[model samples]
Target chain A: MSEDHVPGFNTLSIHAGAQPDPTTGARATPIYQTTSFVFEDVDHAASLFGLQAFGNIYTRIGNPTCAVLEERVAALEGGTAALAVASGHAAQLIVMHTLLQPGDEFIAGTQLYGGSINQFNHAFKKFDWHVAWADSTDVSSFEKAVTPKTKAIFIESVANPGGVVVDIEGIAQVARRAGVPLIVDNTLASPYLCRPFEHGADIVVHSATKFLGGHGNSIGGVIVDGGTFNWMREGRYPTLSEPCESYQGMVLGETFGNFAFAIACRVLGLRDLGAALSPFNAFLLVTGIETLSLRMDRHCANAVAVAEFLSSHPKVAWVSYSGLPGDRYHALQQKYCPKGGGAVFTFGVKGGYDAGVKVVSNVQLFSHLANIGDTRSLIIHPASTTHRQLSDQQKTSAGAGPDVIRVSIGIEDKEDIIADLDQALASA
Target chain B: MNHDSYPDAYIREILDSCRVIAMVGASANTVRPSYFVLKYMLEKGYRVIPVNPGQAGKDILGQRVYASLSDIPEPIDMVDIFRASEAADGIVDEALALEPRPKVIWMQLSVRNDEAAAKAEAAGLKVVMNRCPKIEYGRLSGEIAWAGVNRRTVSSKRPVLSGGGFQRLGLGKGRTSN
Candidate 1:
């Protein structure tokens, strides 16, 4: 099928990168649950290995089912191409590895997920990739943070747990001025809430383990290339701009045109890093994506209701959901995620730590799991868990406080959620 | 019920004595209560550990910001939490798994988990719920200068109209009470 004939979100999610099985006419995408594909002859095998032609070389690099996921996600995100990986962390690593070398730096929002903060602060430092933290609310801070060594500017469209929305276009303008690409983690917002590409992001990434998968069953990640960044124009990104011995000296930008960075990510990053998503997980994620629009609509509506409930609750000290009019990021959310503010938010309980704990204990519906973006409502206390690794000062900076509780609102009935929360707050 | 059925007294003691805690959620941004309370705690000298993942390994209030409680490498008497409730279990588990478990698992004002609290209590730990140690400490230790019942005189002086009232303060008048 051609791009023009491709259908809506629900249709494309199921059939975007797949067709009926050529041999058996199977309606569903089959999990190519094999390590390697066999070649017909020696030359054909050599061509596959040499990247002279496209064929599955190893599951570590790519798989047929995972390819369908990548394609479907790319289409959903309005990107030229995408790569599915083992986890959201791996997706980030792949993008960074392809974009940065030792001594290269990236500017990132301070309001990112706590794990991402740790990755950028400590893990990425191991690779000598420095990250300058920028206040997502302040675009000028991003501009000031950029230097000659800066390769990318990264932000989360709707920051995890924090629920702060980034000004993608404003920051993208900064990246463009600095001759670098802007990468937005669209995990919390998802393509359903906001397509980062539409607002000027050069690339979008997701921890498909969350909303994209809908259920809390699988862990996966995806990187979508918006094909907006001009790698060759300024020669800032040599990995894509220059020729490579990795693929027989093929200059990615010259060969792949707009999708050069994404091709580089697959051929170089995923190939070397070996963080390929499993075919089974890919299939699950695809099924989840098929209901993305529906789930997101409900998620947003439920989240707004929950946020309002929390904000009004006497026990809630503060609520930080972009859907709320008083939220600091509400304006940015309106500009970026006009569809809806997303399904995650943070609120402080009135009694501080004890009240926070009491509410968690009293809640019957919300799952007390370590993961988010589940179809079922999820909640966590960051100061005690996810952000526990950080010191008191660090926790405050990350917006995880002793009194704060984070919620990843699900697509359940809003009334049920509010009722549960009301009882929990009353009990607390 | 047996005497053991009662919660541990050590937990109560830790919760009572630990004032001026450096809650990692202690914000430097004044608008953020974390900042005010952290400053309040610091002024009170109970020792605050600001645990922000973003600022981990950085300095907050002249204190080194460690990532996790275990990473603190020092004797932290209490683990006052500000994370989500789902995250509490893992943190409690981690705290229990520590070489020396924290004296109290103080779930922030609105945070709570009975299973986690029970787990900690089962492991000879103290659990406090629906309370801010800072406020309690202030109220109990005479740190709060105001004279009032339940500290409402000082704390409630700022008339935050409930959700049901007419829009005098931008908040509803009396529909909801906190």
Candidate 2:
């Protein structure tokens, strides 16, 4: 409350959404492991149901521990509010459910996580929500692809595996012109590296399992409402604007103000979908965020060194990392994420698929895994594992070619990472 | 919402994309925040028109002052509200009534109105309540540092890349032909 003092990033990371427990004086946020909360009286219960006041009624809809994690991530991202969900994919489902009705269309960037590509291409078809793919590199493509039914535009702040930084501002403009909100998946570039809200994003999502959880110990995801989009605009998003019959005809946007979208996702999406994040996972994620700034700084530093090493290596065909001076997305990185281009990037092996497979099987320090943003180095041959089911064209479009080997640089000493990769490359 | 600070990136994006800004509650007095905000926006290459009933038929910052948003002849991309929070409703209503309604409704610092904001948003207009465009633009554009004051964050120059066959993901560029 001091007028002169403004909390810095480190301070906010530690104390933004938490205070000493009033009842027990616990400094750290305690995991309220119960399924429900006892109401003060019938009036208190009714007020909570009516959205007259903010209180925990059920763990599935809301929880104290998860609320702290939500507030912490929201503050970190400068978002109006946040909701923690079961996994990254669950977060996407909640967001899409809130935005799309049957037959509504949304634009998505081609360069995205393979799982997301699969989700958008196949699973969403069943729901009757169509996806129109656009090139993230060309901002105009988004405009060209827009139809009257387009409800949103989605892209990754820093794409997975390939470490390509997107033009969030450019696409946001297209979304703005089309009367749609821009959603950016900030899984790779956490708020420490890039805050999508600052770049005109209306909504931001994260796979807390990766960087925010930091240790690969938990599976979690979050949706942050930038509170920039107008969901009530001409009734495009009826779930938020129209009166909800489920809740006695309450209009969420009118009642919640700037945070309507987040409220809708929680009360409707999570409540019905039943993909709520456990309180235990929320506690772990909150703990992980305490050291996010420190870990991300080291991750970027190590990644830059590793990228430089790979780009110059004789056996490496090409390296894709925006932190590299000559990389294609360097300009985007500088403009969007000046801190660094993030820790994960991909490089091609000279011997193609066989060499790529050999490198992943050989690395000692870098664990061969399907995940990124771990505290310890991790590597995977996407073409052989994650993107294996896709066709050659789909693999290429997603930046997972047969020769590509992705590396997620950790906080390890840069020399050890490079030496491990060098040994793996020599073996290949 | 906190009136003191906002996400800097959002502010800069709005400033960059918007060309014509209609300054509501514009004043001819040089010392007022509205006058300076209008002046600073003009200096930043935005086509700012002054909207003040009292200043009609007069010039502020060398641009003719219009009585209200309806009086402006050109399309307005942004409507910067410099009046008190109480006056926001009428201004927003007027903004919404325009033939080609403005895309954004920006309330100045210390001016916050949830009702007006919700109304504008329902009509498909972006709203920034309790914030100032001039201060945000100066802060994010790195021009405020010239006054010898340091904000926690400052803008950095965009990266100049060494380009030749550099493509994202090394997997061809642009969309594939249908």
Candidate 3:
């Protein structure tokens, strides 16, 4: 890599955040596992604490290993800065904490991960924050739901459980009109597949536990600040606009300029909330992201084959994969994620709930687990598992009807993955 | 943006120096968080003027409600916003247009607007976003320790419960035994 030559996505994935370790020249990002960093001198410590210089003070605030992961993801997503947290949920929490005030409201797409629905519907209410549900399929619903109190609009890039591709640009326009930031959960369609920021999203969150980690070994989340939203434009976000009491009258937005939101999340939200990502997890995620482009391509190809097989199968009542031609979200898939509609998709079995359970239990190669983005195929009956907490109507709206079976196609042989599903459906 | 965290010493400096506040987006509803925070600030000796277009000509927490920040007669030291994050921009613009202008713009907990904060700071105003002054007062006065939220400061001393009641801790430094 050189200053003159621009690196491609694959090259940047491996080299963007990393340089030869200054101390030991280690090619791999060394896990700075300890809790604190040594200061050069009294002035250096003062400078760091005073925001006069940039350096690690503690693992809870920042770390070398984690910094690399953050930089890599930021580069991958075309964002100014990124903050890594304990899990995908933690990332959303910090982001909302930075944006939503008690009694403030935000609009959310009805079609979201079951866990996200729980977090927004039940948990966010505890903070006095309200959520207005909107239909992702109908962009006008989002525009209609905007109120003077609406702070943000949230949607998943390729909605979980079902492979429904969202119209990111349409919703982004609505957010723009309402003077709110558009937050996109890019967990399913990693940057290799869809870059939400490029389309109009101001912030992108990832369940690094999924595609970014690729291996499913580490639980991590990331927030990429697109650095596009004008926090000072309307004075809507006082957290970034005003002097933080936590730090003497230092105004984060005024001081940090474009990416002040990220800084606030780090100093204020993460500092107080304590959902810091471990250095070991950062190291593992960095390694996994290195092969993201390669794995994602295979994942998409395998998923298309599996979806086609399922659509024609006698046991499957319907298949909801955007990759398939004539699917409802096929045009959206072409517009948003031109490369692929991602590996995850949903299909309803003819035998309903009982058959859904049988198919999940009968799978051999595809592990029946509460996870996705694994190198190995995975399956789940969401009605009885991931979406169990949701109401019946919620389950249906989220495309997790009782008969729906979700699959995360992996980078395995297309025939093997299809064969596994064939046997499972036969048993059902 | 990486200006870093502000220490407790600075926080104390700002709190110690500030006085009269004009609350933007103040609501008349008793259950609203803005109403309670306004009530708390008023009880703390800070003269607070509630600003809400809908509540204009009415009284909330004993203060006459004004339609906007500019309509308030007195020179306000701080403008505490109780509105949504998107509303802060226009409020900041209005605050900046005032003759003396507010010395500080404090957004309630979870309200943050980076752009508005920058403009205010550039014009020599201090801004605090996504925080509650009532919560800060309680934590700084060592009054919230009973609920176990103030981790930055740890004192073995038990907090004094004011005669006015424990809930009034958001008011001032009167409740702490320390």
Using Cα atoms, each model's DockQ against the true complex is 0.01, 0.02, 0.02
Of 1 and 3, the candidate ranking higher by lDDT: 3
List model 1 lDDT by residue over A212-320, tens digit each: 9999999999998887888887777788877776665566675554566777888889889889888899889988888888888999999988888787777788889
All candidates' TM-scores? Answer: 0.69, 0.73, 0.71
Candidate 2 per-residue lDDT, tens place, B55-165, comes to: 898999799999989999989999999898999999999999998989889998768888998899889887898766765654343232211112334111221111131
lDDT of 1 at A357: 76
Q: Model 1, residue B60: displacement in angstroms?
A: 67
Model 3 lDDT tens row, A1-428: 22124567887788756654534667777898989877767755764565434457788888878877887888788886788899999999999999999999999998899999999999999999999999999999999999999999999999998888999999999999999999999999999999999999999999999999999899999998898998876778999887677666676785554566777888888889999999999999999999999999999999999999999999999999999999999999999898999999999999899999999999999999999999999999999999998889999999999999999999989999999999989989
Task: Write down the TM-score for model 3.
Answer: 0.71
**Best candidate, lDDT-wise?**
3
Question: What fraction of the true interface contacts does model 3 reproduce?
Answer: 0.00
Instruction: State the local distance difference test value for candidate 2.
Output: 0.82
Question: Candidate 1 at residue B47, lDDT?
Answer: 78
Q: With candidate 2 superimposed using the best TM-score fit, by how many Å does residue A56's alpha carbon deviate from the native? A: 0.6
Per candidate, the number of residue pairs that clash is 72, 1, 32
